[model samples]
Target: MKGTGEEVVSLFYIGTAIMLFLAFGLLFIVVTYQRHFFRMKRKEAENMLKVSLESEKNERARIAADLHDGVSGDLSAIKNYLSVLAKKESENKEIFDEIREGVDAALQNTRAVSHNLMPPLLETEGLVPALKGYLESIGAKAQIYFEVTANGAVALPASVAYQLFRVLQELTTNMVKYGNVSKCDINIALNKEALTIDITDDGTPFNFRENLAKPNASGLKNINSRLHAVGGVIVQEEEKQVGNHFTITLKNVNNA
Candidate 1:
């Protein structure tokens, strides 16, 4: 009887051990599946964002080309015809001049819009020159001075360059239009391991986080999205007392 009872006790212990092992295995499987599912979803989201950005870029280029080649060409033709009409019809010379001025202004505005949409310098000379040209044009109009400094090798993939350019463009535009900026400085640092851009502006003080939290802040959201697409980050330096300072960093430059 004693031996039989001992065998029954041993069987109970063995059963409990098997049951615990099965439970743990089931839990591990569940956890692993969940992780894999989340990872796949995150990857899908990133791919979607990239696709959207690429589509927007292509659309901007198309619109810019249309404006430059189609509308600008038409306006130029009209202006030339008007010039001929002004000389032939001297009695209505003032009328012709007025029309010519309007046409010229329209032409200038169209060209400016086209340039902003897809800067020719960006395609021909690269990011730095494009930025300099953009800032120069803005400064001419707004009297805001910009100082750009580049350090290390600044070569980047075309896609990355476009993203960074757009991000900076938004930030600077916001500063000039809303932050009351006068003087701004941009620093670009790049190496094999990392890429960093520091932008400082003597503008009206504002809270980056608070503004970002606003429901209507689509521009800020776009900036965040662009940075995320390139595996980059933007940090607002709180220690700056006078104005706003922002730093963008991408650690895996090669991978990005």
Candidate 2:
């Protein structure tokens, strides 16, 4: 009887141990699944933020282009009419001269503002010509040597061109603002599948990934968002010998 009771007690202990082990295994699985779910949710939220910012930037660019093409053009025509009036009424010297000077100054100011809003060449000509003109303008302003090379001559969609142009502008602005060193290089190549752009500046080297996560630094974030909107990806790196570099690859949306 004593031996049977001892055997029964040992069996009960073994059963309790097995139940505890199973419970721990179940708890670990639940915790792991919950952690994975939260991680996925966080990534989704970040993507949503990127989409929202890109939409806002696109809207701003559209409005600026419209103002330049519509309002600025009208202002230019009015200035031209004033010029004709001035030419015909040369005898009314004082009034005509005053009108001419004021109108001319106003016209000049309008052109400058329009250029800032959206380069007229971007609308009149194609992307390549517009980019060439931009590079020339930047070169004239700064001491830095800027080089641009385009491999193929394919007409890109206007929206794609505009977004890419803005991206290039951002890169140039950053180079001027932060990259204190001298020279910069820009290269654009297009193939059947994709368009690739590389911008390198001999400036102070900084880790883009580190800077991107910092608070209130919206430039890199904005660039990433714009690239994402256009089905493009941007990679940033700092080389040991070279400076900061950005490589942007845009998928051919028309094909897709």
Candidate 3:
């Protein structure tokens, strides 16, 4: 009877150990499956964003083409005919000049919008030069100075380049309108594992966490979505008290 009791006790201990091991193994598998499911969802979302961005680019290109080729051509023809009319009538010079000036202004606005819709520089020259051209265009409106610096540059994919350009555009626009800064600085660097970009404005301190929660922060949200689509991230950089600083990081990118 004593031997039987001992055997029963040993069997109970073995059964308890096996149950605990099974519980732990099941928990691990569940955790791993959840993580994998979340990752797949995130990848799907990013792919959706990529498709949306491509569609947006195509639409922009079509509209820009219409404005530049269709509208601008008609405006030029009108301007030429107006010039001829002004030449014919010497007494109505003032009236014609006013009309001509109006037409010229309209033409200028059209060209600007067309260029903004899809800048030729961006397609032909790449991101940096395209940004330089954009800065020069905006220089007349805002009393801002532009500085672009780089360290051992590597060519970025066109999609990445466009997204980065949009990010810079939004930053500069916000700085000009709200931050009240005069000078802008952009730094670009590339290494074996990452592409790092810093954009600093000498205006106000920026808080990414704060703005990210605001409902009206469409610009920042746009920036975030763009970065995420390209496997990059935008975070507010600290260690600078003078102005607003932001950093963009792209990881596991092949830099050549």
Q: Candidate 2, clashing residue pairs?
A: none
Query: What is candidate 1's lDDT per residue for 129-244, written digit by digit as tens?
Result: 88889999987788899888888447777778888899999998898789888999999988767888999999888887888999999999999999999899999998465789
Cα shift from native, residue 21, model 1 (Å): 3.5
Overall lDDT per candidate, in order of appearance: 0.90, 0.76, 0.85
Q: How does model 2 score by TM-score?
A: 0.68
Clashing pairs in 1: none
TM-score against truth, every candidate: 0.89, 0.68, 0.89
Top of the candidates by lDDT: 1
Candidate 1 minimal-lDDT segment of 10 residues: 152-161
Q: In angstroms, what RMSD does candidate 2 have relative to the true structure?
A: 4.5
Task: Write candidate 2's Cα lDDT for 115-202 as tens digits.
Answer: 7557667767867788878877776787778888888674787767767877787778777777785888888888877888888888
Give the distance in Å from residue 22's predicted Cα in candidate 1 to where it truly belongs: 3.6
Task: Candidate 2: list runs displaced more than 4 Å.
Answer: 1-58, 84-99, 115-127, 154-159, 191-194, 250-256
Candidate 3 segments whose C-alpha is farther than 4 A from its true place: 89-92, 151-154, 191-193, 252-256
Give the distance in Å from residue 42's predicted Cα in candidate 2 to where it truly belongs. Answer: 6.6
